[model samples]
Target: MLRAAFLASTLVFSVVPVTAPPPVDSAVDCDYYCDDRDPSLPLSARRSPHRPGTSTPPAPAAVVCNRYCDARDPALAPSNRLAQTVVVAGRQVSLRFDDTDAMGWGAIAGAVQPGDEVWLDRSFDAGVSWGAGSRLGDTAVPPGFGDWRTMMFNVDDWAGLGVGLLRACGRPAGSSTIACTSWYRTTWNAWDRRTAAATALMQRYNLSTGLFDTTGWWNSANALNAVIDNIRLTGMTGYRYAIARTYDLNRSAWQGDFINDYNDDVAWWGLTWLAAYDLTGDSRYLATAKAGADHIFRFWDSVCGGGIWWSSSKNYKNAIANSLYVQLNAALHNRILGDTVYLQRALAGWTWFLNSRMINSSGLVNDGLTSTCANNNRTPWSYNQGVPLAALVELHRATGDPSLLTKARALADASTTSAFLNPGGILFDDGGGGDVPSFKGIYVRGLAALNRALPDRPYTSYLRRQADTAHARDRSSADSYDQPWAGPFQRSDAARQHSAVDLMNAAG
Candidate 1:
């Protein structure tokens, strides 16, 4: 059971009655608003914010309609709808929120277009919402310095982003070689990493069983799952997928030679596989998730006066990892149907995070330990704060713990207002020197996840607005992928195209 924090004992593991979706009424149907009262509007239209007008404004630049447009919009339609189809490895996936809910893929429906106007900000909120298509008018950066790369090589994290975009958008109902190839290659890369790391860890550490070879370190099962799924999707053979078990303390390089259950890698991989099982109904993925869950359970002792250790190392007890542990366990308990033991583990881990790591009054979650254990204690990052909010919400759903909900809401409030997010809710990474996208991406992801978990009218609307603002700024930048310091902003048509896809995906 979750240890009582600020909430009184009355709010034990009892479940709260979820507020039903509001009845649909004749309101300004934000292209994607949800109202149970009126299910007549398309779910996507309901979730969408009310656009200023139905007709899209003219594109700032002209892009070739290409094969995707030829296939999807027969007339080579230059409408915003055609722009909604983002290219992936020379293929484009159309964005239509006809079936999905606000929680699923509503954020990015607007940005994926026939042309690259809107850009997707992956970190801020998955691709449910969009960023700017390309800078609006003169605000747009011209192609130069960063322009050559954009022109010469359209290379981006194209494959991964494509798969993610496709998954969120409707998977191509038909098999497009372009979509398949992009999906295949991306999954292959992820698989390669996971396999290499897992193999190396098991061999080096002789990790036969238990939570991990050492408790203080991290785990890689979840990472492995992400990789494996990619591999399966792409159908790549002999990919030499490598996964590592630990990070070298001196070199700071992730060592792939041994298994350690301390890291929350298991949770991520297991969850991924669990998702795969749901999507594909594969028994192997389910089995793998179960094994990983069992390993996680081994470490769930009443340690450090609360949750499990960050890793096997007694010195490494930290909040970020433990909070992840809470989320992992809770996901398994709530989403996946195995390992009931994780329920108690999730409860305890959440309680410790709330009582110890969470910043009282501020509702911010902190990283328990860092380079300097004493001073670095409780210094929070978006990921640290964000993941816990997600966990708290999930736990609240599973256990009806009002405190968890309150804490999650509080954390969400703090994150939206913190330095991590620009005033408009674009997530920015702090202490990253200034790798804006990567930094903000994680933050945005956390917010997006929270938005999905907690479906309130006010909160959902805010998420939509924030999603729009981030995309607009992102499109204004010279290079979508490169940070300001990434060797002078390089702009490419591919980059612009990607930006549009990213933005539309985020809006969904």
Candidate 2:
């Protein structure tokens, strides 16, 4: 289905047989040294290039969440969301999403405690990885310039009411709430933009019957992510309109004649509902995620020697669909205890994807396998690389196998290089038009998940460079973020903005 520019036929997707892994020290020098032979040594210890006695260094300053926001763009104004309060330990902490003057993450902005550190162990990843509490308000910027609380506020406000929602530009804070230009419409933010845009795309373009639109499912999933992310951060309420918009209520399944027939699109929404269930403690969302997982596994066959098909037509097997399969299983495994089936599915899918020759010699993941089961030689999309990176990391956590972690680290390291990034670490892949722009955000999200898992790794610093560059160079005075992070602002859309938001949050 993907008609990218470089699609080419290759020999049957030849199996890269699993020979005994070359000795850990001499495995062609991937991201870090591939050392999994020893079980007890921490991954950092195993990959250490320094002397045996060298101390494990502190995390780089650039990577971890510092201050929430600052005068980095003196232009940023306070646009707080519907304020909400939550009980932390026992005391209630009032939090806002868009406070230009907020102090810490959840506590009332400006509420700083001596030696205070935020404990970040979130389900942002399918599994729970703790960051061991980093210093709150840890940026080099001047005090009060920014705080952890308002970090995502400015971005979401701009995307929703600032630009995408209210279509207001250069207006002062709170102007978004009022009808300024004789035209008034309901406004949305990160809390609701994905659902709005995706539904619009679906209504505007879906030819398929019953379903909102095949393409809308992607943003539908994104909207679901936005809602989950909002509740996770600001302690506000959750919105399920995105789910209602894309979901087929009559059939009660995401993929059907009324919705996505493509397995991956269906899987995307299923994963979203899973995140919602994880956050909202709703069994309905979990049930939807499980059904989606079952549907994804149904597509898995021995046809290409075991990988999920891209569509029900069963003509092609792709990296995107398969990688998503891995991710869904990984997340399900994280949510479900005493269930080895999800882990089993994750292991099989990952194993097939890894050896399927789609990942070429440079460690870049190719697009899909041709009808003959050969590497299709399609231009590597960002999602292909990103989804599997987190999936593999999740798998490593599930099995306690360092080999999976080593491979995930390799993917993370290689992704930051020319395979995906341009100079200054701005992520660059295909052009910004069409769906290509959305792909990078998925990759960046994967990077964030990996960062949460390995807080001390350099991945966080590199991703920070991406977020900072995006804020500094990608956007224009109009507040619309452009393509190529550092280049031409041509063709900005929900995709680019969403990726930008993901990157900044990752930095935090």
**Using TM-score as the measure, which candidate wins?**
2
Instruction: Give the per-residue lDDT of model 1 (tens digit) for 76-159.
Output: 222211113334433233322211111111112222322222121111111121222111111111233111001100111222
- State the displacement of the C-alpha of residue 331, model 2, in Å, after optimal TM-score superposition: 1.1
What's the lDDT for residue 152 in model 1?
9
Q: TM-scores for all candidates?
A: 0.46, 0.58
All models, RMSD in angstroms: 21.7, 21.5
Off by over 4 Å in 1: 1-262, 300-303, 336-339, 369-378, 419-425, 433-439, 475-506
In candidate 2, what are the lDDT values of residues 302-348, reduced to their tens digit?
98799998766666788988998998888888888898999999989
Error of 1 at 383 (Å): 0.9
Consecutive 10-residue window with the lowest summed lDDT within model 2: 1-10
How well does candidate 2 match the true structure in TM-score terms?
0.58
